[model samples]
Target: MQHTNILIISDIEGSSLCRDYESTTFLGRGWPRACLGMSKDVNAVVRALYNAGAREVTVQDFHRTGFNIFPEIIDKRARVVQGYRQGPVPGIGRAHGATGLVMTGMHAPSGADAILAHTLTSRIARLEVNGRLMTEAELFCASLAPFGLVPLFISGCPTACDYAANAIDGLTSFPLHQEIRGSEARAMTWREQMAAAAAAALKSPAGRPFNPKGPFEAKVTLRKGSGEAQKLAARWNLEAHGPQVTIQARDLNRIYLELVRLVYLNRFTQHVLPPGLFLYRIMGRLGLAWIRRQLKNLPPSLR
Candidate 1:
């Protein structure tokens, strides 16, 4: 494990204190608090990685808008990548010699009865590759394969942990309970427990890169009555049946980028995406600053 470097991909739905759809998006009633909790949860793991002798740790904010975690609260030792990026790997660039990846705040794929379950976007009912339901953890792990990075660990809801464990051999998963039925004092222990478990899992990590069989077929089923499928199919020149659109590719990375384009971009937007992403990054920073201001204005008891 000498000179080990770890990459952490963080999402909102599986953050320690995030509980519902509302908490997963900006300006939702619980969004600010959720962001704070996510920061502390990630900070604990950052400390643990460093203590475990990791030479470098990089965190990618993989959730919506990619601006969820509060940088001020995260461990300064780790490099944090905010917002989205475009490349062969999509939001995840090349592994850049990182030894392994650690995904935090992950959730189950769409159609699962897990906390805030969805893949890529809630607009899509589900995403399937080679007839099997897809999860972000699986996609992220597969994206890093060309760079020789394996999945070291994951922490999230039970369903999410199970999906990742089943998909990648020898991957260590820590599941935070879906519900904590007790006093707030009792409920607050999950973060500490998660930190300890994650640290323990990384003490001696073992796993191979996830390389799913390709010549892939992907089915994107948009939610019923959403009227999005038709628009997307028309935009991409793909055929749509009812609410489902199908995509085929020769490899996982190609399929992954296709899914990204399906969910986030169209022909016109693709042309202006660079500028759009820049503006979005600015908006994300402003949104986070606003959240910080709101938190500061709250009474100390609530804070």
Candidate 2:
């Protein structure tokens, strides 16, 4: 049977970017756990695509530092792109060229007040382009639209699901948990979510993505202590706060590249992690972490 070239953009290991978790605010923490489960999520998606007549499955380990996808656990046939610095930067089409794509363990844009509401950094107060709100996931997915690649499946916490369903069409989601207050409240087991994801993904097909023109308004508000605001302002005149700066972009990828550069600078000034990472691996870590935690919590009978 021939396999389709399906790319899964994951941010499981990226859940720590929220910096809200008691465990992962610090760099290099909580990523290993997320990567393990992200590997399985990749497998589950691959299982479905292979069963549904896919030819290839490539999972982008899009999370922190961008290189956390554990190749040992991921299906040997699937390709994993890890880390941000080593990637084309997280934006649409960066993961394009696939027959179809899946965005797993995603979250809402930093503009909205979802649990971890920050685009690139908590330092970023907000990201707006041409009066529309923008999140890293949205920017990343929108980037894919230009490549004519459709995102078919997405999984993560409820917020992640809600974000994907609203942003990308024909994209189904597997919501792992509902956040109440701060901690995980109503959660779905990883196996259950994966099973459900596989079952729900059976009927999906590729759809057109959002490919809009730029020179669009781009704005970002940074957190206190992050000079990213001024640095970004120097690039383009938009807006600035004590810890924020906004810019306008004629190119989405251009803006994305700018963000990537800024993030690297931030890391250099702060915590030192891996050197080369890609787009897919950075975000996959976050959602994958949530998925695996459920698997660990599963009762023996359930397993």
Candidate 3:
């Protein structure tokens, strides 16, 4: 059975070109190239999904500014969703009619040994749910559960893939090793293998949506002093323990939104969210234009 609409959530930390913090940051010189690598990775999977009988594909740029993917480079058949949205999920808006989801260019959660490892924010020392270290893949899956979308495929660093697979049983994943960067030939081979595997996962579409039963407990450990944690705890009315703050909620979706608030918002920002988002959208357009110019000057292989 062909999934009518499939969503591919793309990040940057696990993309082939991302080597460190500089590669993942929007202002860094390597960021444009990193975006190109990510766009290519997403396009490969998008093409594979189309060939595997998917009727429609949606690619959501889920990196820092949500403007990393070069829309001009990805498969035209896929609708690209960019920038942040104020919602339960925060970034990607509604699930629409998507029956399944794929995660690519994802990295390991906070406290992991993967390159550019961090949860929602670098300030987060660690994030735990039900005593287990939680991953963004798990959180994304749970947030989309109400839409009845199952996690179909994931491609990322070894640690990320392993954690995602463990979180969602029977989910398929491709681990793009660090050694692949040693040569262009190896990178191409890795992309081919990942695309084929992603297609197969979409065709089979195994497992159910990750809707773990709750009352859920989220423990967020900050990297620095307890002051920040105490402030956030007081603001959210959560429990602050040392440098950590704990949130309890009956729904995973709620927990996700709260986590977003913790990572990206404050009292002043929260009140001015609409204007802030508008400003961000304008900035994103300018940044994207700059990236276009950079891409044009680069060689075909890099683009």
Candidate 4:
């Protein structure tokens, strides 16, 4: 069957009402509230798309564990894609025939001076494709291009909006928050404005795909203290250039997969841990907290 689906890729750090590590972290103190805010922001865009005559909407939970959104609170008309899955994109697959892609709650790339800014993970200090610096949005857009989908709109902070506008030609964007200084931002509570902007964007002409001509050369710069870079360099047969690892691939799919493998390789245990092993969960949380604290203490210039 032919489908006119709009794929909404949602992240937490760029949500309208989100602020601080507690809001973005899965098990942090303010996570519940952040989840609710993210759900509402997604639903607003979903409803707007439906109202604008979109046949279907799919909300991809693109945050931690791919399960941050509350299923019950999201728009019932939209199907939700949750959990970690293997694909060119985390929640996207070959079966999706999305007419447009909407990146909701997306933050800026690492080193971009936005609230909670980082690329795929805190460990990745920089990512470049063919020596061009990339934002997470650009990477995902390149992945979706094979499916003939183009980015239509993005909702996030002002930095995110500017990044999308600059990266994807003719793309529309709504800034739900504006960064004041460092991690502080002023939230824009106008859901109606966001909805209207998104609806209009979907109806407008699609933006140019961000795909780069391949064979692709990717360089990943790891944070100074992260040991994962050495491990990844050995596993991928890549050359370690101080803090950076260089990987070459013939296509975007290989590049995407390699990056994912590097970032989440250490967390494989979390998926296999038995639910009843509550002690392991506590240990994992403490370990993650320690790692984050260390990342925070890294020279601000590198972060």
The whole-model lDDT of each prediction reads 0.79, 0.56, 0.83, 0.71
lDDT comparison, 2 vs 4, better candidate: 4
Clashes of each: 0, 58, 0, 0
Q: Write out the backbone clash pairs for model 3.
A: none
* lDDT (10s digit) by residue, model 4, range 49-76: 8888888898888887666676666778
Off by more than 4 A, model 2: 1-3, 13-31, 84-96, 179-192, 195-206, 213-215, 225-228, 235-243, 262-303
Instruction: For candidate 1, write residues 1-303 as lDDT tens digits.
Output: 433688889987887667687777787877777787778789888988788778789999888788988887888899998998876577765668687889888899986876678888888788888877788888888888888777878988789899889878868888878564112343358777777766666654457778877799888999863378888888888778878888888877677777888888878898998899899889888888877987787655443
Provide TM-scores for the models.
0.92, 0.70, 0.94, 0.79
Quote the RMSD, in angstroms, for model 4. Answer: 7.7
Question: For this target, which candidate reaches the highest TM-score against the unseen true structure?
Answer: 3
Pick the winner on lDDT between candidates 2 and 3.
Answer: 3
* Winner by lDDT: 3
Q: Least lDDT summed over 10 consecutive residues: which range in candidate 2? A: 179-188
Output the lDDT of residue 277, model 3: 85
lDDT at 2 for candidate 3? 45
